[model samples]
Target chain A: MRYSGFQVIKEALTGHKGWKPVWRDPEPQSHYDIIIIGGGGHGLATAYYLAKEFGEKKIAVLEKGWIGGGNVGRNTTIIRSNYLLDGNEPFYEMSLKLWEGLEQDFNYNAMVSQRGILNLIHSDAQRDAFTRRGNAMMLNGADAEMLSTEQILDRYPFLNVNDARFPIKGGLAQHRGGTVRHDAVAWGYARGADMRGVDIIQNCEVTGFRLENGKCLGVETSRGFIGANKVGCAVAGSSSRLMSKADMQLPMESHVLQAFVSEGLKPVIPGVITFGAGHFYCSQSDKGGLVFGGDLDGYNSYAQRGNMPVVEDVCESGMALMPMLGRARLLRMWGGIMDMSMDGSPIIDKTHIDGLYFNGGWCYGGFKATPASGFCFAHLLSRDAPHPNATEFRFDRFSRGLMIDEKGMGNQPNLH
Target chain B: MIINHPLLGPRDAAEFTYLGDASLINRPDWQSETAAQDFYEYGYLRSNPAGIHRELWFHEAGDRSWLVVTRNTVTHEISNVEMARDVARTQGRSK
Candidate 1:
């Protein structure tokens, strides 16, 4: 049913008996035309677009665990398009546009709140950098505004403006960027894809690939061997592990990134605030809890939990940004395994193996790039060519020396 | 996570910078015939094991020494630590 105020009121009056499960829990079929591994936000959205836009048939999404059990449900849930690089700016801007119309398109309440995102400046050099970044964003058809220190203070008065080490200078605000209810995004995409006759099989893990002479035919799964004509893998942090089954190595490292939420308080933060000097970014949830995160735990591990030092480091950065944050008690903390690439960007390209496509290395940007990643991935899978916006995210970019090093931090996955 | 430094005593792993696979220190000769392929393998191909692993960590906050830390990836337990310079010397490298 198409959800609306009328539907809510009608359901409330009629005991809500007509409400249905968001998506059907179906068993995996023997064969599929297109099989997508990892039923996270990107996978589900990819299946949704493949059927909706590309008119592909017999699509199946196989999730090792429950839908949204991965990073889709375990992220800080911020979204933005304030990118500077030519290869990245257009792609992220496309994602922001998709996020803007996502709820209406999918007929779900994702709560895509465009409350805006502010990146604080702590020095003259940062202001200059953000100035260039804002102009680049605007040139890419995305909204950006350079806010003065007084304007930033006016918007977020709780922030500490007078600090000896890292003084507050100014900010770059993207008024179109904001947060969404992370879980609902998964549910919405799953429902949309299922409605189009795509099967979403949960509790189904891919064990290996079914290959013949360097061409992938299907996958061997926990349930059994599920046959497919083509397979697309979007298993984020598990990219290397899964691809290794095919004896392929990726230029990505897996690291754990932790996020924290504070105890609920009165609404104070108007929107998202990112400290420029450090690696902390925060946004106050609708429930009045401040949700934030920082750098990844610097190691290669598949573990979802992180160590204490990174936690302390994150809290220290948050405290540095806003000393008032000290009063807010941390309620909960969790970690997501990030597929950090060599150049600190993502990779979405066909691998050396035929009929096998890969989409990963998203690192911290995976959550925000859900819609566009799925859309462009679907474009690539359907057309067997790079999308107009994602030409730089190729497998050979490293060898070709066309790395999309956004942070200019060369080759270090942890620093990115 | 704490790494018991060979010289500086027990230190928090946070202060140390992590790099994957201490085997990276063994740089293949660039003048060799298979240098291109060797460098490709050296630069990109590295094993990511789930159990015990020997990796590199720089004591950036301490004495600026590179360390070879042998730790379990699954349990986060450190079993051994040695100065990477010493380890490099054993591997027949200088300067």
Candidate 2:
């Protein structure tokens, strides 16, 4: 049902029995025209756009677990388009635009809050780098404002300005960048796709792919063998393992990136604030909890839990940025496997195996790229070509020496 | 998590930088005819096993030495840790 204020008021006036489940739980069928593995935000969004925009039918999204159980739900929920690389800035800008209209387009309340994001600058070198990044962002059609320390202090007074080690000199602010309710995105896309006749089969783990004679046919799942003419793998951190079934090794590794939310407190942080001297970013959730995260656990693992040193280091950075956070009690923390690529970018291209398409290596930035990743991936699957904005994200970029090294980390997945 | 360093006793795992598959130390000959393909394979591909794995860890903050760590990815348990220089020397790696 289309969610609206009228429906809510009508249901409130009535017995509130008019509401239905957000999406249906449908069983699988024998065959489908297209099958999308991993029903996270990307997979569900691909199915949604394929049906809603591309007019493709007979689509099925097979999820090993329930929806919103992966990195889609385990992120800090920040969204921004402030990228430096030409190959990445435009695509992320497209995603930011899509996020601007997501709640209305899907008729779901995703809580897309555009409060703004401030990447705090601490030194002269960082200021120059941020200035270049801001120019790049503005050139790519995304809003970016260079705010002085006074302007940042005017907005966020809680930031530690007296710190001598890493003083906040300035900040690169994106007024359009902010956070959203992470799980609601997965739910909205899943509901949208289910309404458009896309069968979303949960608990259907793909055991192997049906590869014969260098051509793909279908997948062997825990439920049974399901046949599909075309198959797209949007599995985020599990890309290496999932593609290994088809005997394809990806140019990526999985590392655990953890996120944390503090106990409920009064509204403090007006928007997302990232520490420049270290890897820590935080924002106040609508529920009054401080949501934040930092670097990965620096290891190759598929496990969903992280170690403690990263947590200590993250809190150290937070306390360094805002000394008052030392008083706030830690509520809880969780980890999600990030598919870190060599250049810290993503890969959305067709594989040598016919009828198989792969989309992964999103690292910690996957949550923000949900809309555009899906739209571009759907474009690729439907038209057999990459979208104009996403043409740089190819599997051959590394081999051809066209790698989009965003962090300039040079083939280091963890560093990125 | 604490990784028992071979020379430095117990140290936090956060001080170490992870590089997957200890086999990367055995770099292919740069002058070989298939050097491009070999480097491509060396740069990208991985076994990425779910169980025990032999990996490389750099002590970036402490000794500035690389360590060969055999750890279990599933259980987050370290089975063995050795100096990567020693491991490379044993493998007859020069320069």
Candidate 3:
């Protein structure tokens, strides 16, 4: 069933009578080809690709919450491939490519609007850094352009042309980067994968790992024990906890990142804009509200509720960038738990255990990289060989001192 | 008086030093300064202000303790201003 945006809404309204979940084996199948823990974007996408690419139809994706109820649903859905490090550039570009063709591929209107993303430069140092990054993107065959102040103004006239504190310099505009409907992307993958006979189990939390002689055999969830030959851990927030239950620790910190939406207004902002000096970026939602977010609350917190500091900081920066937002009241605010890795890059590799695979450490950029991450992760899981682009993002890179420290920011929660 | 310089740029001098805490310098606003001072005196607050840059000191180690600072570049102001040791002690006591 190739469903579009309207069709999906209609189906939801009319009730999915014909659709039966493939994961519900009445007799309870003893095992599956692959078991994907966590039904977020990464896990669902992985399941989708496993069935679509490798022809592994007996795949199961188990989620603790309803589909699209995790960070995949909470994130500010911005997509970009303007990574600075060598290790991340190619893979993110691949993700960007997947994002480009996602709507057509899923037959779902993800609203993947490539309105372009502009990372504003504040200092001369920042300008040089963006220049280098833009050059790298160009060398890697990704679309990126450096815009001047006049060019920026010509493009986004609503922005403050003269702000003294952080003067408006040009930005690194990735033409391919943009925003998508966060929830729609998740539902699209769920509907698409479910159509291809993949079982998506919700309200099923993995309590423990079924290990036999140091190898993951299956998962013990709240629902029941499900056996699997291969198990993939795509759980983001609970990655550390799950791995610890298996007596392992990946270099990850769970932090709460918050996002805010302003009162609905006529759309003024066209593309996504990120501030270099300040931890803030915003995009206009289809409903005309200005959706934006800033740095994570600087403490180890699994609680999804963020403090007022981040919200105030984001709003202040928004006012600085576009003064018109001063009068615009904030409509709502929300938070998501991000698994911030030490290197700020994701880990897609076979774990120390033979059959157990892990895919996490997405930081705040997981929503946009859903397709590419899923594809590469699926390829790695199916072939037992890491994709060429994501080879450096191995779990052992931390011990080896080969960390891909993009943004020149350290792995510490406070810094990230 | 609004001092406008090329490097540091223009800012209202009246709004320079915070109103509540004179020990702390360059607080974002009166409300924030009061909040910080309230936290400092009482050792806790329901919530902390977001997105402000602040300079603080820690005094547990000695008469002059480690300075703790949190600031936001966009606002060009301090969000938190308190002693690191004080914060640690407060948090430790709470826990």
Best by lDDT: 2
> Model 1, A1-416: lDDT tens per residue?
67899999999999999899878888788999999999999999999999999999999999999988999999999999998899999999999999999999999999999999999998888999999999999999999999988998888988888988998988999999999999999999999999999999999999999989988989999999999988999999888888999998888878889999999999999889999998999999998999999998889877888988889989999998889999999999998888888888888899888999999999888999999999999999999998899999988887767889889987778888
Task: Kindly report which residue pairs in candidate 2 clash with one another.
Answer: none
Which CAPRI quality tier does the interface of model 1 achieve?
medium
List runs of model 1 lying over 4 Å from the truth: none
Worst ten in a row by lDDT for model 1 chain A: A394-403
- The stretch of ten residues in a row with the least summed lDDT in candidate 2 chain A is A18-27
- Fraction of real interface contacts that model 2 preserves: 0.62
Residue-by-residue lDDT tens digits, candidate 2, A1-416: 88888999999999998888877788889999999999999999999999999999999999999988998989999999999999999999999999999999999999999999999999999999999999999999999999999999999998997788999999999999999999999999999999999999999999999998888899999999999999999999989889999988888888889999999989989989999999999999999999989989889887899988889999999999998898899999998999989889999999999999999999899999999999999999999999999999999998888999988998778899
lDDT of 3 by residue, A318-343 (tens): 88888888888889999787887776
Could you tell me which 10 consecutive residues in candidate 3 chain A have the lowest summed lDDT? Answer: A19-28
RMSD of 1: 1.5
Candidate with better DockQ, 1 vs 3: 1
TM-score of each model, in listed order: 0.97, 0.97, 0.80
Q: How does each model score on lDDT? A: 0.91, 0.92, 0.76
RMSD values, in order shown? 1.5, 1.4, 11.2
Candidate 2 achieves a global lDDT of 0.92
